[model samples]
Target: MSSRKSILEAIKAIPREEKPLPDLPDFGISGELEEGFTQSILGNKGEVLEKSVFENWLATQDFSKILSLTESYRNLSTIELPKDPHELSTLDLAILEGQFGVAENGAIWLDDSQLFLRAIPFITEHLVIVLDRKNLVPTLHQAYQRIGDAHSGFGLFVAGPSKTADIEQSLVIGAHGAKSLRVVWK
Candidate 1:
């Protein structure tokens, strides 16, 4: 017998044991989901806002170059979605819809279907994600249960603004992506 065949036969002859999956601890913070989400987002250097607060904040800004994909804020949209992802490098602000938010880590789920250009959120100077308050989950386990395996080839859990501490342990926000992140809960 060839050496490779002999090795394969020996490997196949070995007994294997099946192990049960470990049970995840119940964080049990569902009742405080909103507070947990707010604290987590604040820890990640992101801001959480109510609809009225966000609207009031928006009113003070210059909307000349804002790009909004959500239907509710279409009136404030100034630029069209770029055909090329590279063209998004100059975006000042981008407002997109998030499918859900996780309270454990303050992450918002975004899939390819929700993003006109995959780079819009990352390329913009500021990113605003609009998510429904009812869609908040207490943990990543529950968040995954909600998403399942059905996705449009691409998905991401964005936690906050891009940051890097690579250089001399110095923190840098917006090092490679949006400088700030604001979550608008409706």
Candidate 2:
């Protein structure tokens, strides 16, 4: 037998060990869940608005270019989306629908099923995500359980606006992505 074949046979002779998966810890929550979620979002420097007040909030915006992928706001785009992704660099705002929100850390889940282009959220100057209150979960462990094997292609959890800190620890917000993120929920 060849050296590679001999090595493979030798490896197959070794015993294998199986280990049980560790249980996720329960991080006890205090007070109302929405309150905790709101606080987390605030700590991440993101804004939150109720679904009832979303239209009123929309009236206060001065953005000239906008795109809305949500069915509720299907006709809300001011400019037609360009065919080329590179042309979207100047997009002022992009409105999307998140599948769910995590209460513990103010993160919302987005997947390719909803995004027209994967870069729309990251390239836009501002972003608006609409999530339902009923879809909120208390922890990431539960979040993972809910998303198990469902999103096979692409998905992400966006906590807040793009932020980064350099070696000196000076924080930079919107350095490479959306300058602002607003969560409109029901």
Candidate 3:
């Protein structure tokens, strides 16, 4: 079979809309958001945690080694992102300051300005997203209010770690994308 067919088969196999939204209308999503929204996409538990608790949790885990493995990781502090996405390394992760959030799927719409590597999200062993307490949204429908026609540049709404359950109905996380996602709210 062709690679495209194989990929399509995999995506189709995933259980569609298996997860449901929570009952509360407030849902703890933020309201003062405009362009580039992406929060409500995550899920209920996404909002239940305190920022302090989340930050404290990060201090407990070890990401130093993972950072060292990437060929261009150390150079990011001094390097500027190339305008082209093709220039990004497969293991680079960009910590961007999100402009707004998407409520429908708990995603954050970040501008390329804060990114160090253009394709950082697609080619990284780990991803760490940091957000301020001020930016959060309720639903994907609400997120659409922020996107304008000039979405000419690149953007993405990421939720949790990358995952796939393509084999034997198994539930696996971090298959093709980063093996882990570290979210910090301050």
Candidate 4:
């Protein structure tokens, strides 16, 4: 046999033992999930907007391109979703709905359901996520439990705008992704 095939066969011949998965411990966090969530968001360099004030503030801006996929702002969808994700390179703003938010880290969950195009959130200059006030969880443990058995092609927890300090240990936001993030709730 060839060296590559022999190597593969030898690897497969190694004996293995089965191991039971460890049980998930119950160590859920307590306190006001909303308050903790807000603090977490601030630490991640993201902001939460009050519904009343957001409406007025949103109307004042003039973004070149805008896309809204949230239920409340569905009427604002302007761009025709393109077949190629690269076509969104110039996207200015993207408003999407987050299924839920994690209080422990201010991470918001989105999948194919909310992110119609995988690149929409990443390519947009500014990202706005709409979440239900009641959907905040105290911790990621609960968040994972809540997502169990759910199915989707793409899923992720977006915490804040893309940031990097690799260049020279200096913080830079939107170096490769959304420049800002704002979460709005009804």
Candidate 5:
């Protein structure tokens, strides 16, 4: 058997916060999907509207070739990103638009820019999104600035799965939107 090291030695390696943390809203995912947090954002407004409003968004694109993924996004077919990212039907998830809102936490802002899906992300069932860390913000106030006054159409800010504690204060998830969320930062 290998020699065992004292448990106290391991704790010393961990880093501690240098400053006091600020109060904020809880938007992290919990429960079975507690460990999964992946998100994709498209750029611009025209692209965002086209994708959300039309089901045939990929009609002209060649979805007959790419394969699909198995993990959490099994529902999503492996659609290839266009050679020119601007080709509406080219991206697996085209981030064509975004409207910011106040976040109660030091986390980044959110809006319809990421969550307006009509179906599952993978064919197998369920979905997953690993957001880019650069998008993170310190508070919701900053999020509003990002939005400005561009209210072209519909939008929202989603935090984790749809959960409720109505039945005897018991928390339940997956009631309205996604079943899980996992926010991984760099």
Candidate 6:
């Protein structure tokens, strides 16, 4: 046998063991989930918009290249989602649907199905997420429980706009991704 085939056969001969998953602690706190979620997002330098206010705000903006995946804002979307991920890099704004929000960290769950193109959120200049107010959870433990068996291959928890303090400890927003993130709660 060739060296590569022998190496593969040797690797396959090794015994495999199955380990039990660790038990996650319950950190569920009782309070207003929306309030906690809003506070956490603010701490991360993100903006929260009420649905009523967002309507008026949306009408005033002039975006050249926009993509909307949410049903509520489909009328406002300028272009269809392109097949190529590379095409998303030039998007000025991308509006997407979020599965749920975690109050403890202000993170929102997004799966591949919701994102027509995975790069739409990160590559755009600005990103907008529409989430139902009732979908807010108290902690990550609860969030993970809620997301169990729901994701399709890929999922992510997006908190706020991209920021980096790698250079001289000075914070820079939009350093690696979207410069602004606006979460509209309905």
Per lDDT, what order, best first?
1, 6, 4, 2, 3, 5
lDDT of 5 by residue, 42-134 (tens): 110011112232335334544443322223233445553334323322223322122221223322244434434323221211222334434
lDDT (CA) per prediction: 0.89, 0.86, 0.53, 0.88, 0.36, 0.88
Candidate 4 — what's its lDDT? Answer: 0.88
TM-score of each candidate structure, all chains considered together: 0.93, 0.89, 0.54, 0.84, 0.39, 0.84
Candidate 4, residues 1-186: lDDT per residue as tens digits?
999999999999999999999987755456787888888899999999998777787789888788888879877777877889898888888999999999889999999998888988889999999989899988788888899999888999999999999998999999878999999986
Worst 10 residues of 6 by lDDT: 24-33
Model 1 TM-score on a 0 to 1 scale: 0.93
Better structure of 1 and 5 per TM-score: 1
Task: Rank candidates, TM-score, best first.
Answer: 1, 2, 4, 6, 3, 5
Off by over 4 Å in 1: none
Put down candidate 3 lDDT per residue, 119-156, tens digits, no spaces: 57656666766665476665655555566664436667
Best by TM-score: 1
RMSD of 2: 1.9
Cα error, candidate 4, residue 174 (Å): 0.5
Ten-residue region with minimum lDDT total, candidate 1: 26-35
- The candidate scoring highest on lDDT is 1
Total clashing pairs for each candidate: 0, 0, 19, 0, 26, 0
